[model samples]
Target chain A: MRVALCGNPNVGKTTLFNRLTRSSAPVGNWHGVTVDVIEKRITGTDVILADLPGCYSLTARSKEERITRDGVLFGGYDVVLFVAEVNNLRRNLYLLTQVLEARKKAVLIVNMLDEARGKVDLELLSTRLKIPVVGTSERAKNPKESVLEAISKANAPSLPYLNEVAADAVARRAAEKNISPEFAALKLEERDAFIADILQSESSQRGCYGCRGCDRDRPSALRYSYIDKTLDGVVSCRRRYALTDKIDKIVLGKAALPIFFLIMTAVFFVTFETAKPLSSLLGRLVSLAAEPVKNADMPEWLCGFLGDGVIGGAGAVLAFLPQVTLLFMLTMLLQDSGYMSRVAFVSDGFFKKFGLSGRAAFSLILGLGCSATAVLSTRGIAQKTARCRTAVVTPFVPCSARLGVFTAITAYFGLPAITVAALYALGFVAALGALKIMRLFRASEGEDALLMEMPPYRVPSLKRTFKAVFANVCSFAVRVGSVVLGVGAAMWLLSNFSVRYGFTGGSGSSIMSTFAGALAPIFKPLGFGDWRAVTALISGVAAKETLISVISSLGGAGEVFGSAIAAASFLIFSCLYVPCVATIAALAKETGWRYAAVSAAAHTVTAYAASLIFYQSARLAQIDMKLFVVIWSSVVFAAVAAAVAHKIYRVKKRKGGAHDSAARKERK
Target chain B: MNLSDYSLKRGVIVSVGCDDDTHRRLVDMGLIGADFYIKSRRGGAALIDYGDFSAVTRNALAREITVRER
Candidate 1:
């Protein structure tokens, strides 16, 4: 049987889906986590269950809601498991009522019942709704069996409030469109933009078609009145002092930004400082594993391939596994604890100034985990312009794959924490800066709506946290096995073999050098213009982890850059350059090929210019500090002067235009 | 008064006067003719509790929702 799970946002649909399907799709304690439909088969049954995005009602507004509406209404599911949270059952039941009005077979699952603590009378609820009701919680030992059992006997309840006039209108619409009267009732009653467009197309008439005088709010009002009556005896919510209120006072208060900063600092400390020993141990283990090949009395070329190409390259990236695991764990904690929502809530105003909503915060945070996946999450953004802008800039934030590269390069500077943190901060600033620049080109589409859910804070589940971290580690291991291994071996072969001297076993006059040499001069202004740097950068486009591996094979960053300033410039360039092919493909999928190509070009050009400026400034400082200070002051002064001049010019032009228009009007 | 102009935290929603899309969404959430509570406001967005759910809406939406202070 084909079953689908649908509900309002953050009602634990994904949690139930994971339990029933034995799959680990991501679950967060906030709304909009599942932006698209995900499907999986039940563990033992032949039932394929699809998890649709959350919607307030069948009348879709946002992209996510549209997806859910289309899927639930027409995805050919045998039954729908409509999940609702106990705390918000009234609002959730609004959607349930709409589903019933549309004549869909659905079973109501009142979730988070543990929090309800017997306040909800499931028997009464089931009796009133005339459908099978199952009360469940995250701790339910076997909710799947009960849920599936309920689904097998799914039925649609009658919404008795469709009066004669409404019934006639629905019937007329049904006859005209050849659709079911139940669906027609919903379409005509809501008469939302989507339904209006459909009606407009159904008739090529210039005027509103099918239904007239059907008040848009009447259906909702009637349904809510019915719901209030049904819920009157079914629920008895005692007014208890909520802890969420107390927490919000502090979390969403004036100090929210500072607290967020402190929390991020703590996360970084745990990732870098606490995990340092584990990373060192892993590094030593990799070196020990490669020692046997280094000591073997084999052909020099074969030794280099085995000892350096495969083991050394992959191992270098692998050494940072501890940091990656810890970072992912902490990020999941913040997400699952519900603190991330507050951050979004607090940051909304600041983000709006840059032509983004607070919703972009989630995408940017996820970008720290994976740019490709983060770009996909931008679909939850309500405004198309905001979504497009967010997708374009998500790659500017360094993802986990680039972590190893940053750590390796910054190690040469000896202030790993400070330098790495500055680089991350720079990435965020650059992303915001890009958005500000994008705002100049694309006009605002009015104020973007943010009807966000503020889920009560809960202790993040340990099982989910570990599962998420394990997934990250598994994906990283897979990359090491495939992309890193292939690129490492190929780079090693190219650098070691020459056309004339068959196996030179070094980079001298080799195929890799010849190609990299051609690309070196383009980066000469950034100070790391060596052929090895060029090769690592090119391999990085394939996968960021491959960059670190190639760097390890070509010798460490210390050998590649040779100077502190050059290393810093390379780090900045890496931070701002185009993301891996996977992210670009994801961007293309979310936006389009034209946008993806242009964004990639924009990122590369921006990275190059920034790196060049940094390198030149650093070189100037090395030569004479006074000269460096003077040049920087002059640039800053000139920029401010230009901005002021432009503002004055625009003001004068506006005044002149007003005067001319007034003169013309007087003459008329 | 509209929700954005209501100084008191607790109120009752009178009507929603937004564009069709946003008005429909607000109505679907049962915000009309229900007890409303403003939980917080930041960055021109307000977190409102109505019926059994709380939602954060931007100021533009808040301004279009008429309410009577409790």
Candidate 2:
């Protein structure tokens, strides 16, 4: 039997799904984490469980919402497990009522029972709603027994409620108007085309005509009236209870914010500083493993390629994998505990003023971990224009790859670690400022309701946290494995090949030098217009982390610290420059090439302009600005100019609206 | 008028339709509650105020919901 778990967003539906199926999918308190549908089988039963996207009602408002709607109505699941928040029974019933209306075999799983505080009258609710109710707390309780019991009791066929008179009237209308009862009802209710089409098709097949004897136009009004009357007796809620408010007071009251900050700071501190020893240990193990290969009677070329080029380049990235994994785990823990949603809510006021939704805050936070994934995460934002704008600015949010660059640069400049951290903060501030400027010209015409749920605060589970972290890290490793391999080999070839001289004695005379020199002038103002910096930026195209490998290959890892401040400036420029190719491609797929091109150009110019200003200002202040500053500043200046140009283009296009309207009309 | 302007508190079913942009989104998401409940409210960033228990920012919430205060 196929079972589908369905619920509104942030109801711990995914958490319960993970618990029941023992699957390791990432769960977030924020909405739209599970954008696509996932299916898995129960171990003992012939049951396949489908986890549908969290939606308010099955009415499709976005692509994710439509996925849930179609999954429920047409996906042919044998049983629908309706997950709801126990504390918010009245609102949860909105979707539950839809499930009943669909006539789908279903059972109610009231999750977060631990947080419910016995406020819900489950027996009364079950009897009134005419469905079996099972209470569960995803954190503290094992929902296995309750879930199994509900499934065993799911023998009855699904029968959704309709207002009695309205159902009869729809039936009569279907006969008279040649529409099916369902179709007629949906049409009368003025539901979306998908629902209307479903009903209409059913009625047409049944040989129903048009609305002849029935009042077809007034069906929705009559049906709602009928529903309102039924709700008078069946549904009741207490005004004074304020369960969520009380919970919030206990969890996120004024003190909760500080506690949250402490936890987040602790996560960053532990992941970055404490993980160093573990990461070094892992690096040593990898090096030791490679020693035997080096000692083997392999060709000199093979040894050098495997030991230095392949393993070295890849190991340089892999050494940080432990830290990345730890970071992901901590992020998932915060998310699972539901504090992340509160963070978004608390920060929404600040972010929205910059023409971004609170959701963008989540993406920017994720960007600090990995910009590519952060770009993908923007799928959760409902408004297309806002999502694009967020994508445009995301690269500025210093990702993990850039973090390595920062460390290398700090060592090069002999600056304090706090200075490196301050640079990161500077990048964040710059990103927000850029977003505000981008918003002025590219204001999102689309309106997105920023509805999110504050999932009841609970201590995160080690099992779930590890699972989520592992999944994210594994995906990142796979991506890095492929991209880094290709980039490593290419860099090796570029460093060895000299067109006229054949194999170059050193990297300076190799093909990479030629290419870097050709592009050096573009970044001259930022003080890093040399071949080494240029080559690093080029390799960064493959994956941002590849910059570390390129830099090491060109100037050795020791040079990272000697040029510390300039290197730091370079890192900042690299962070804000064009996103890796994969992100550009993804943006192209989501929006269009035009937008993607614009995004790339804007980032490159912004990085150039920002670096230029930073270098110039530092130099004038008598700060020991290094050679890398010139190149960095030039790139930053270009980025600013491109952003300004793009803004102007958008404004002009908006003012040229008649042409746009004509084009839209033509498309229609 | 903004949703904040209304006296409607929790548990009240408000009648509100999405403006042009939100309308397209609601139509896409299959959100049926042109009329629905005010699930919860806090002084800071209204949480899960309407439409299938989804959390919405107060700014967006201000534009999307209009309460029928009793």
Candidate 3:
């Protein structure tokens, strides 16, 4: 059986699909999460279930809607499972009405049944609509037997009200194309651009081919009226302020921006702070695992290969699993709860100023976790320009891979964790700055206005949330095992063998060192030009964690830096240098290699320039302790002064408004 | 009144003069003949709730929509 899940945006279609298929298709509590056709087998049954992107109707107003229309029309399906939130019964029926007219069989699963108990008359609905209606709390509900039974016994329901002219036009088109009459009729009635083009090609004549459809704007209203009439018989919703509305009164107010920042800061704190001890513990465990392998009386090369080449390389990457999991889970939680939309919705104003849209916020936040995945998420963005801008900036944000490098290097220098936080902050600042610089040469175009849905905040499903987080963790582990381990093994072998094919184990006289030494002079101007620092950066392009291991193997970073200025400059270079091949491939997949190549080149050039400035500035201004403390105090005082002045200005403005109103009253 | 005039207020859409593509999308997205409420307004975009549907629309697009007091 080929079962397909279909619904309006944010209506738990993907949630139920995830549960039924045991697949993680990135169900966020936002609009347009699923943009492509996602199909998987329904276990224990000979069934293939597909999830289509959400659309309000059978119309193609956006990219996702187009995908949905094509999928449902062309992808032959045995059954359509029309998933909808019960509280949204009226809106749900609009699509249901259209689908049942064309589709063979469907089970109406009223998700969020907990909220629609007495208000929904299911039996009356089942009778009126002439279909099996199953109520489910999709937030946390098991598959009911009725859903399966309904799928097994597939039958088309009675067709609802259809305009005579529209039906005839649709039937004629269906006869010509030999497609489903109901689906084709509705698509033609709705004036679907794709269907019109298809019919246009079949009929070379310019005259009207089939039935004369209603006015362009009439079909949608007609559908809404049909839905309203259908609901008048079986559904009743009491007008009440929902919990989401009450919460929105505060969350959507002026304090929303600060609240957003606070949430992000807390996430950062939890990820980095909690991952510290856990990372150390993992590193210790890896060392313990390696001890026996090292002492196993095997040949020296074999032990070295097993110990450092495989175990050590994989271990270095795995040690940061804590941070990776934390970041991934937190991002998923935000996405699931629907705050991610609000964050995007609110940020549109600020982003518009930088030639980006509010939708870019989703990709940027995901970038903090992993640039490769972040680039993939940009598919959710609507506009082409916005998507491109988002993909280009994604690599500039420090990803989980680079985060581990930053943490490891910070610990090496005994720098405060705050130093790492500052670098992360710098990444965002640089991203926005890069947007401004990049936009200068291109023809100026206004940013797309935000047209996003703000889904009601719901408690994220723990099962699905953990499922997504675990899937991400597994992917990261697999990458470490394959890509990072391979790169590490190659680096280890190159360092151990000389160009003359002699094994000089400890000395920096091997092919790797020789290759790195030649490149060292190129970076000498930035202060940290040592062969070790330069070599680590070259390896970083393969895998970021490889840089950490490479630095360790090529005599420690401190041994290369020799001063705070050089160390800071090298860290900055590391922060902004070329993203790993995985991220580049992801970017290429999303846009094209032309964009991917530009991103790689931009990062490399920007990294060099930024590092030069940092190195030269630090060298020019010797910061004594007294001068540092004085500068920090002055900045703190200025911030406090600005806040007080803003408060006073607000107070005066309110008073003046009151006085002006009183004067108007006196004149009256 | 037009949609932009009903800031932070709830009303029912009377009619939408969709002279352009954006307003056409609004009507097609089920924004017409429904109770419309604004949650917030920022950067020329109004966050609104049309019945069970929620969306953010640019103020320019909102001007094309007409609404009546509920």
Tens-digit lDDT track for model 3 on A1-668?
68878888888888788777777777788876777779998767777889998877665655667777667666687788888877677777777766776655777888887666347877887776777887777655567466788787666765655534355655676768756665665555555656667765343221232222225555566667776766775767456437778877777788988988899889989988988999989988987887788678998766776776677667866888898899889988988887888888788788877777778888888788778878877877657766777888888899888877787777768888888888888788888988888787674345454357777777887987888898888888887887778777788777677978577663678787788889998898899878778777888898887877666544456886887678778878888888888899988987899989998998899899989877765665675656656765787999999989999999999999999999999999
Best by TM-score: 1
What is the CA-based DockQ of model 1? Answer: 0.53
Model-by-model DockQ, in order: 0.53, 0.28, 0.39
| Residues A1-668 of candidate 2: C-alpha lDDT, one tens digit per residue | 88999997777777877777888766876666776788987656667888988887655666677778888877888789999876566556666656665667778888877765445656766665566778878557667776877886763332233443255645764566443355345543543456445445443322122221123223333334433443454434434335555666555555755776687678767776777777777668767866776677977556656665677667766777877777778777777766777777666667767877677888888777777667767777777778788877777787776666665455445567676567667768878888878777866664456455555556677877777777778777886688876687678667767988876644578898887788888877786777767877888888887887666545454553234445656866886788888778867765678978987888888888878877666665565455556766787999999989999998998878978898899999
Give Cα distance to truth, residue A299, candidate 1, Å.
2.5
Clashes of each: 0, 61, 1
* Chain A TM-score of each candidate structure, as shown: 0.94, 0.77, 0.85
TM-score of chain A of 3: 0.85
**Highest DockQ, which number?**
1
- lDDT: which is higher, 2 or 3? 3
> Which CAPRI category fits model 3?
acceptable
Residues B4-66, candidate 1: write the lDDT tens digits: 888998989877766656666777777777897777888788777674666678888777777
Which parts of model 1 have CA positions greater than 4 angstroms off?
A163-179, A199-214, A646-668
* Candidate 3 residue A360 C-alpha distance from true site, Å: 1.5
lDDT of 1 by residue, A144-236 (tens): 788888988899877777543245654665557544575565556566556546544343211233231237667787888889888997888
- Report the error of model 3 at residue A137, Å: 2.1
Error of model 2, residue A192, in angstroms: 3.4
Give the least accurate 10-residue stretch of model 2 chain A, judged by summed lDDT.
Answer: A205-214
